[model samples]
Target: MFGELEMVKALLDERKRVVVLTGAGVSAESGVPTFRGQDGLWKSFHTQDLARPDAFESRPELVWEFYNWRRQLVAECEPNPAHHALVELERQIPNFLLITQNVDGLHAKAGSKKLMEMHGSLWQVRCTKCTHAREAREPLPDMPECPVCGHLLRPGVVWFGEPLVAGVLKVAIDQIGRSDVFISIGTSNQVQPAASFYQLAKDHGAVTVEINLEPTPNTGLMDFAVHGKAGEILPELTTGLRESLS
Candidate 1:
């Protein structure tokens, strides 16, 4: 890990465009649930059963109940060291972008200005009838409604069957294509589009790195694979980059 850290730091020393893609494992360090496997079951319902548009359509109340629970749970968790390290990376890199799959809003809380929440955020709500959306951190009602319209509101996250916002996806791909260094952090590397981003970066000649608790399916593709808790690895990696830059 130390040797790989030095290599990643050397890559960053080039001062080229850097892009980072993070996932649930990053937030899990802060005690946020990944909403997968056994622990994710709520009221005997799986996350996939409730996080789809059809599920929300059939039982908006039930859906809101789930989301509200998630909101409350995520609200209690704060940004960990990994999140702060990414913020530092953003500050040090002249051309940097952080694309995150986790919607917990930890990166934003950690003061990441150059960020794209590809999966949307738990802190936002959008109108079901209109395009209006806004941040709402408060405990919403049993059924949240849009202030702009009288219709019901839904969690602003991209659901299981929903496509990512086209413009945001476009920008993320463009950044990955242009990146000199691309890092995949704490993701399972199984989710689509994002799952393939490392390949896109590599195809475009970017130095790819993976930081995860364990090797992912895409681990073999990375120029460097550093395994450990992101909260520990990221701060050390970013600190090394800072020292190398100095």
Candidate 2:
């Protein structure tokens, strides 16, 4: 972990632009269960059934129940070391972007700037009928209605069948396709859009680095793959980079 981190740090020091694409692995450090993991509350319900737009239409109360539960869980968790490291990394690097797949607001909580939430955010709400969305101040108790259309509102997160927001996706692709360096943290590379960002980065001649607790399918494709808990590894790597940049 130490040796590879220094090597990656050397790349970071030299790179003009560094873009990061992070997955649920980054937020898991903060005690948030991933959407697909057995520990996740979604175990009882299939993600496709609960998260889709059709599901919300058919069962408004169920959709609210699921999101409300997730909100409660997120409310309990705080940003962990991995989240803090990214914020610190952003502060040090002059050209930087952080793209996160996890809907949890841990990145913002850790003070990360230049962020793109590709999968949407759990702290937000969007009207099922209308396209309006907002950062919610209070958690949903009963099935809430859209203020504009008086239709049911659901979590703003990207569900199974829904497309990623085009504007946000376009921006993420633009950065990933042009950065001099790209780092992937804690994602398994099983999901699309976010997984494809790595290849896009590599396609554009970016130095690629992966930091995770264990290697995944895409491990072999990365320039460097460091296997360790991201919270522990990222802080160490970025801490050195911070001092060096200073």
User: Which one is best on lDDT?
Assistant: 1
Q: What are the per-residue Cα lDDT tens digits for candidate 2 across 1-246?
A: 678889998998898899988988888888888766566447478755787878877887887888888789898899998898888888888899999888888899889978988888988988867788999958675888888999877788888888988788888888888899999999999888777778899999998999998998989999999999988888898888878877
Per-residue C-alpha lDDT of model 1 across residues 1-246, encoded as one tens digit per residue: 889988888888885799999999999999999887876799999888899999999999999999999999998999999999999999998899999999999999999999999999989899999999999998999998888888999999999989997699999999999999999999999999899999999999999999999999999989999999999999998898777778
Q: What is residue 158's positional error in candidate 2, in angstroms? A: 1.1
Model 1 ranges off by over 4 Å = none
Instruction: Please report, as a residue range, the 10-residue window in candidate 1 with the lowest summed lDDT.
Output: 237-246
User: Per-prediction RMSD in angstroms?
Assistant: 0.9, 1.5
Cα lDDT, model 1, residue 59 = 98
lDDT of 2 at 40: 41
